[model samples]
Every structure is written in structure tokens, then in C-alpha cells.
Target chain A: MKLAITTSGETVDAALDSRFGRAPKFLIYDVESGAFTLLDNAQNLQAAQGAGVQAAEHVARAGVDAVITGHCGPKAFRVLSAVGIKVYTTDLPTVAAALAAFKAGSLSQAEGADVEGHW
Target chain B: MIIAIASGKGGTGKTTVAVNLALAWGAPVWLLDCDVEEPNAHLFLRADSAQQEIITVPVPQVDMARCDACGECSRFCVYHAIVAPGTKPLVFRELCHSCGGCARVCPRGAITEVARRIGVIETSEVEGVTLVGGHLDVGVAMSPPLIRAVKARIPHDGVALLDAPPGTSCPVITAIRGADAVVLVTEPTPFGLHDLTLAVQMVGALGLPMGVVVNRVGIGDNRVHAFCAAHHIPVLQEIPDDRRIAEAYSQGIPIVEALPEYRALFRQLAESVTALCAARRFVTQGDGHEHRGGGETELRPLNPATGASTTEGANANVRV
Candidate 1:
């Protein structure tokens, strides 16, 4: 299974970016292959609007099974759910910890958005 | 002639000044409350025969059969309002600026323009003015389109007084664009001075003639007037910080109607503004830079909007 984690840095130990849409970079990790790839989100970071929707499109195009981030807004959550991708929110501060929790089946899938849009 | 009443800071008496000035003119004029976010001038004008018109902007709708999922429409939208993922495009109507470029750039004739309601425009005729206000629907992030609809109601030959929204942002520019002259309302405090300077830069950048009306004169220093003096902008009228005026304003009554004495003050203000507009236009025809504000000409001693004379240069060297 492959999942995307919104991160501040390139490494898995980087602190998890609380923002899903405007996150600086989204680090994708594959559980079966133990591979890590970086998705640059600089284009949507300072977008005038629709940052959340565009970010969701990026992850959707990357063919990820799920998205793990600190928070998801209404637009992103809607797009993610529409594409049959589960959204898991974590406040674990580090991507390594979040990834471990996900593999251990401890992180629950979010039913809906945790924060308001433009937060 | 179109006169836009604007202020950079909120609650600096922009609505109060616009309403009273329209009434004090004592003639038929188009009073447009262009602040679509929270239109409150209607509470005071209380015009008769309210008529409402719905405002709409064009947004793109994609036909999947013809779209081919090429992502052309998504790439064409500068606002990122349209995006295609997994062979289907999603339209976020809130992010659309109604530019209509997506439909035009569609390759297979798949995209079509559809009307999207942004706001509603209401018009009513009062004794002194015809009040036109734009009410934006909730969750409508775009305001300039609605503001444009409100201004479109102004007659070509008729006079108009626009109550502009606060801050020097896109909404304010959309409200005040094409006005003959702008009246920037401000107070004497430091915050007022700072925002007034920003408002002046914004108006000045548009190459429009503008004047300052210092509201709540006694509350702070005199740096606003000094800034005006340095820029050659005429100090048009001063509204004192009076408890009676505040009380009347709080009760939804216009100052010109409740006080009755301030009527003369706004009338004089109207005359001064007319002179400024006329003189600036006359000079703009020849040399635009030489006669910006028509500074200090025929002000006729405004009876202070109230009985109190605003303290002049209260902090002449305060370095505001």
C-alpha cells in the first residue's frame, strides 16, 4: 500500500505539516517496496485560492491509497473521498511516528474534515 | 459626476458620511452602497419601493463526453477554479473569477458557460437619493463582480455618491473605479493617519482626484491634516467626536435628519466637493499634475459639521 504524508522536510523524520493543502512538500511512502518519493507542492502553497482542491488532485493523480496529514479541509476531504481514498489525520508531529502508527493500525480513518477551509 | 466616499480603516464613519452627504445634497442622486459584504446604508436611507435584481457571473461546465479528459480547461483557468483528476473535471464555483476563458479555450467544444448567482442588487428611492445596494450571498468569496453590478445602475448623466468598503483592496477599487473624485474619510489618530496614507496611495495611483474629511477630530493628534498639507490634498470637512452624533448614529438615524444643524455643514461640504471636482477636471484637461486637489480654494469656513472647531495641528511635531 502507498500513502502520502504532508511533511515540512524531505526526510521521514521531518515534522508533519498540519496543513494538508498548503503543505510545502508531500512525501509519499510505499509500504510494500519501502520506497520514498517527494512531491513538490510549492505551486499551491501561495495560490490565491483553491489550494486544497489542487493539492487533492496532485495526490489523486499520484495514485496513493490514502493521505495522512495533520488536518484536511472540506474541499480536500471531499476530493479525496470522491476518489475512494481514505483520509487519516494525525497530530503526531513527526512523519516517521505517523507512518509507524498507520502501519500498526492505530490511526483511524477520518470520516470528514477536521478544520474549516482556508485554515 | 461620481463621488466615491472611501476610508482605509473600518468604522471610521464611511457609511455615516456617505448617507448624510447624499441627504445634505438635497437633490436627486444615485447613492450606491458598494460595500457588498455587509451593506448597512439601507438601514438609514430606508428608501421606498424596493426592487431586487439577481446578479450572476459566467462559469464553465464541462461535458464529459466531449471533454476527452485532456485537462485543457483545467490548464486554462488561471484561478485554479477548474481541475481535472482521474478523467473528470471538478468545478469549484467559488474560486472562479468569471473570466470565461475556460469555455473559449476548450478544444472539443465540451465546455460551456453557465450563470452562477453571486449576489443580489436592490434599489430604492429615498427623498434625497435613489439608494442602490448590493448584497453578496454567504460563502461568496468574490465581491468585485457584485460591486460592479451595483455601480452599473448609475445613470450616465446623473450624479452618484458611492459608499465604498473599507481598506485599499480589490473591493474598494472596484467600488471607486471611474469616479470623478474620491472623498477619503479618516480620523486624527495614528491608525487613521497610517491607513489614510495607504488609501491616498491607492487612490493617487489610480490618478484620481481625492480630498480628506477628518472624522472624529478631537480623539487623536493632527498628523492627518499635516499629511494632507504635505500632499496638497484639501481637508474637505471635519466631523467632531460628539456623543450626541454617536447616539444619533447608534439609533439608525442620519445625522442630517436628527441633528438638523449639521445639514448646513454637509451642504457646505457638497459645495466644496463640487468645486474640487470642477477645478480638478478643468486642470486635468491641461496639466494633470499641477492641479491635483485644487488645494485650499473656496472652502467657505465649514461650520465644523458640529459646533466644535477641530483642533488644528494638535501635535504638529509628533512625527506621525
Candidate 2:
């Protein structure tokens, strides 16, 4: 029953995170303990050589069951999906709003697959 | 002395440094732009074209008349550019790294390697400097081969200044190998700092001795300086944040020519690079880890026993 939540660090509140790996910054919150951790993105590590895979591995190792972010690129989505991680989308700027939606059971796991596009 | 100017992010003025340094030297300094994908050095240093060569990569094209749909060629491709028997073996030309394993394993000898034009290397003289650059064809995937073409054009006897591609990818590796010294151009911003860290790692991984040049020095946080200090990388020169410089760039002129005062700064940059090259040679000749992985990161077939091709993934479209 460990839900790994991804949050954009706009405020000290919960916001829906739709992006899988390339989100500007990622906050991993433990649902049961309410303990939160921020991950400075290493997505640009080696500049697309191992950027996506490295970030995905770090997220996976943190035991995040679900990821919330702005968007998920195809490579990260494939890696996370293969490991049974549910992703949720949110437009909220901060982490507090995302947690509120999760607590209210209003935040739904994203139904579609992560699509790849350059921004 | 050979100097390489590289940046982790594009548009960070690698070509600008190389071109200006060549001008500062006044001698026939060899300027080679290894960016390959979008070489802008020519746009700045107007060169009279002395030579132009077409760069090509080996791609396996199936001869339908000779082969049955055995799927062996498809199986042999590590990139999975070739699909299995049901459909025409789809080749995502961009994704293909051009290792030629598919052609090697084809039982019918049906796979013939056709040279696909990837880019071109043009060599010329500009302001008494030998200028060379590889211009990648639009929509072409590979760059290392074109970079190789540019490297081959490097004159052996003089000071060769190489303008490397942005980012620490395969092409960057190809450009930086055997470089006597590297100048990492960076800005003083958060994004610049982040990418600079990766570039530092990449140059360190290659065991290439490198220095830093802070472009637009006073604009962002001093994180770039702090990073260089922590890493012990020498700071070469800081190009001032000026609008005239931008105007000069847009007008396609080297700042050394557009603004003569900057010529002295580039001259010093060239001098510093020579010093760095000497220092690296001294240190490396004493140390055992002197340039091990300086060649291409080529991926040939893993093992003949593993049936020529391995499963890339279930999602075939992920490749082609």
C-alpha cells in the first residue's frame, strides 16, 4: 500500500503531476508516512544519452508507486509502465494541492499512455 | 597545439571562440567545426571553399530478388531498424547507427550496404586560417562519421582549433578525442551550470584536460565559477554580456573582427590553451591513465553465438 507521489514544488502543497520523468523537479511523497523528498532532476545527465533512463532508475529506486508530473516523454513512460507505476496528471503548481486531491480520492491515475513530444 | 571548444548546450558560442581564436593567432591556425549537425562557423568566418567531400554511412538495403523473407536480416539488426517478415523491413534511417551487422549476417548476401549521404565536410581558407566544418544533411541521423571527415581534414603541422558540437553525446566524443586541450564554453545560469556539470563529466570521462570560458560573464548566478573552482578547472576568459556582440553574431561576423578589442582576449585564450596542452602532456605522460577510450563508441554484434540479433524490445516502433 505504498503510493509514490510526484509533485511540482510550487508550494508546500500537493498538485497533480502528469509528467513521468522530465518534470522540472520531482517531489516523492510517501502516502502512509506523509514523509516527502525532493529530487533535483538529473534528466539532462549526459544530454539524452542516458538522461531519461537514469532519471527513471532514480525514481524507481525511491520506491515511488505512482508518479505525478506535467508530462511524460515516451521513453520514461515505457520504463515506468513496465514496472507497474501508475501516473497521474495535474496542472497545479505546488505539492499541497496535489496531496489534497489524493486525500479526497479525486486524483485519478492517468488512463492513457505517455506520449513523446519535444516542447 | 590543438584546442577544442565545446559546450553542453547549443548556441553557447563554441564556434565563436574557435573562429576568433584562429583570427587572433594570425598564423594559419586550423579551425575545424565538429558540430556537424548545424555548423555555423562558416557563417562567421567567411572561407573560400578549397575542398568539399560527401560523408556517407553504410546502411543495409535488402535485395528483394535474392532473398526469401527469412527475417534473419531483421533479427541481426541491434537497432531493430528491420522488422520481421510480415511487412517490408521498416528502416527508421535516423535510428540506425549503421554498424552493418545486418549485412554481415544476411545468409543470402541479399543485404548490400548502400552509402547514405549523412553530411559534408568543406575545407577552405579564411583570413589566412584553414577552416573546416561538417554540415549534416537535414533529416540525416548520424553525425560521428561526418565529424570524422572534418577531423581527417585537420592539418597536422599547425595549431588546430576544433569547434565541437553542443551536448555530451556520441558526436561530441568523436570531436574531443585526441584534442590537446578543451575549452568548455558556459554561461552563468542555472541551466548552464546543470549542463556544464554533465559536460565536465563527459570531458573527464574522456580523460581530456579542459578549461572553462564563461560566456556572458555577469548575467547569471556565479554557480559556474563555484563549479569550476570545486573541480579545479582553469577559467580561460569571460566574454562580456553585450548587445553589440549579439548584433555582430546575428550579422555573421566574428567578434574579433566586429569588435577589435576582443581580439586581444581571444589571443590570450589561445595562449592559455597552449599552456594547458603542455600541462596535460606533462601530467599524462607521468600518469598511467593517458587517453584510453579515445576512439569511436562503436557497437558491433555482441556475440556470434547469440544468433546475430538480440531482442531490442517488444515495442518495435520504439526503434523504427
Candidate 3:
């Protein structure tokens, strides 16, 4: 299974970005291979509005089964859920830590957006 | 000729000036209330609407049966109103700008336009003055389209006055875009002067001839007067800070109708505006700048020392 994690840096040891939409980068991790790839989210970081929706669309197109992030806005949450992408929240320090929490089934699944749109 | 009454600050008497000017014209004139968000001129005029029409903008509707979510529509939309995550695209109608880029970029022809009503325009007449106003639907964020719809009702001949929204934004631009002249109404306070500067910059950017009407005079300092003089902007009219005017306004009575003596003042305002518009026409024609018509021109901030027409200066100061 593949999962996406919002990160502030390119490496797995990079700190987890609290913001889902304006995160600096995204790490797509493959659970089986234990490998990850980086996806740049700089375009959305500069978006004046609707950054969350655009970022969600970006991750959805990458075929990620789940998303791990500190926060998700209403618009992004709606878009991800509509595409059957499950969203999980975590305050873990780094990408690797977040992935470990997900593996242990300790992350809380978001039933709705964790934050309001435009937050 | 078409004249637009605009103010940078709210509650600066834009509606008061527009209504009184239309009434004072004493001819079959058109008064377009382009402030669709909070149109108040209709309350004062009490015109009987003869025609009404709904204003709408086109939004995209996707056909899911086409069997492919190419993500072209989402990628093409600058506003992010459309998002294609899987086999279907989600459309958020409120954020749509109706640019139709998504529909045009779709290769499968799966996207079609659907009209979404955002506002209504009504035409009415009161005492020989035709009143046309737009009322935006609640929660509708876009108002320029409705303002355009109301402006389209303007006739080719005779005079028309547009009561522009009180701000130097897109909606205000839409209201005053093609006017022959603009009257910026403002008070005498510091806030009034600050906003008046913004309003002057906007009209100057459009290269339209503009003058100032200082409402509620004698209540604040003369900084507004000094600014106008320094910029070579004409101070066409000054309405004193009379409690009676406010009393009359609260009762939905136009000053011209309430006092009757103020009619001559408004007439003088009309004459001054005509003269200013004529002078602008002459200047543009003589300099061969009329052909540019709302196009790129030099922009500079108003330097009180210059004391010349700052139209080009204002145009140059525009950031974009």
C-alpha cells in the first residue's frame, strides 16, 4: 500500500509539516518496499487561495491510498474523501515517525476536515 | 454623456450625490445603481420597476459517463474551482470565475456550461428619471457581472449617472469603466482623505476626467481641499454639515426634494461636470490620446508641486 506524508524537507528524517496544503514537500512511501519518493508542493505553497483543494488534487493524482498530515482543511478533506483517500492526523516529529505511527494503527482517522477552508 | 459617482470610503454620500444629481438634471435621465451588494438609491427614488431580469454566469458541469478523468479541467482552472481526483471531477460553483477555460481545455467534450443566477437587475422610473439597479444574491462573491448587466441597460443618447460601489476594487472598476467623467464623493476626515487618494488613483488609472465633491463640509479639517488643489483636481461642490440634510435623508427624502433650495447647487454641479468633461475631451483630442481609451499610459504619484493634470501620473502609478 502507498501513503503520502506532508514534510518540510526531502528526507524521511525531515520534520513533518503541520500544514497539509502549504507544506514544502510530500513523501510518497511504499509500505512493502520501505522506499519513498519526494513530490514538490511548492506550487500550492504560493497559491493565494484554494491551496488545500489544489494540493489534494495533486496527491490524489499520484494514486496515494492514504494521507498523513498535521492538519487538513474542509475543502481538501472533502476532495480526498470523495476520491476514497483516507486522511489521518498525527503530530509526529518526522516523516518516518508518522509512518511508524500509521503502521502501529495509532493515528486518528479524520471523519471530517480538521480545519476550516482557507485556514 | 455618462457620469459615474464613486467614493473610496463607505458612508461618504455617494448615493446622496448620485440621486440628487439625477433629480436635478430635470430630464429623462438614467440612474444606474451599480452597488449591487447594498443598493440604497432605490429606497430614496421610490421608482416603480417596469422590468426585471435575472443575471447569471456560466459554470462547468462535467459528464461522468465519458469514462475518463484526464484532470485537464482541474489543471486548467486557475481558481481551483474544479478538481479531478479519480474518475470524476468535483465542481465548486461559488469559486468559479466563469472563464470557461476548463470547458475549452477538455479533450473529450465532457464538460458543458450551466447558467447560475447570481443577481437580478430591475428598471424603473421616478419623476422622469429612469432608475436601473442590480441586487446581488446573498452569499454571491462575484458582483462585476451583475454590474455589467445593469450598465448594459444604458441608452445611447441622453445623460446617464452610475452610482458606483464605495471601493477601489474590481466591482467599482466595472461600474465606472466607460464613463465620460467621474465624481468622487468624500467627507473631510482623515479617513476620507486616505480613501479619496485611492479613488483618485483608480480614476486616474482609467484616464477618466474626475472631480471631487466634499460632503459634510465644516466638520473636519481642510486637508481634502488642499489635496484636491495640489493635485489639480477640481472641487466641484461642497455640501455643508447640516442636520436638516441628515434628518431628511433618514426619512428617505433626497436633499433636492427636501430643501428645494439645494436644487440650484446640484444644477451648478451638473454644469461644472459638463465643462470638465468637455475640457477632458478637448485635451485628449488635442494630444491624440483619445485613441488610447483606457489603455496603458504613464503613471506617477500626485505631486502637489506640479499642479498639472495627473491623469498620466496616476496611470503610471498603477502596480499592474
TM-score of chain B of each: 0.88, 0.84, 0.92
**Positional deviation of A7 in candidate 2, in angstroms?**
26
DockQ of each: 0.60, 0.03, 0.62
Off by over 4 Å in 2: A1-119, B48-50, B86-92, B287-320
Per TM-score, the best of the predicted structures is 1
Ordered list by TM-score, greatest first: 1, 3, 2
lDDT of 1 by residue, B134-219 (tens): 99999999899999989989899878999999998889988886787889999999999989887876666455677889998899
Question: Candidate 1, A3: how far from true, in Å?
Answer: 2.1
**Which should have the higher DockQ, number 1 or number 3?**
3
True contacts kept of each: 0.57, 0.00, 0.71
- lDDT winner between 1 and 3, please give it: 3
Local error of candidate 1 at residue B156 (angstroms): 0.7
lDDT for A79 (candidate 3): 93
CAPRI accuracy category, model 1: medium
**Chain A (alone) TM-scores for all candidate structures:** 0.98, 0.74, 0.97
What number of clashing residue pairs does each candidate have, in the order they appear? 0, 15, 5
* Whole-structure CA lDDT of model 2: 0.70
Candidates in order, TM-scores: namely 0.90, 0.65, 0.85
Any idea what lDDT model 3 has? 0.86
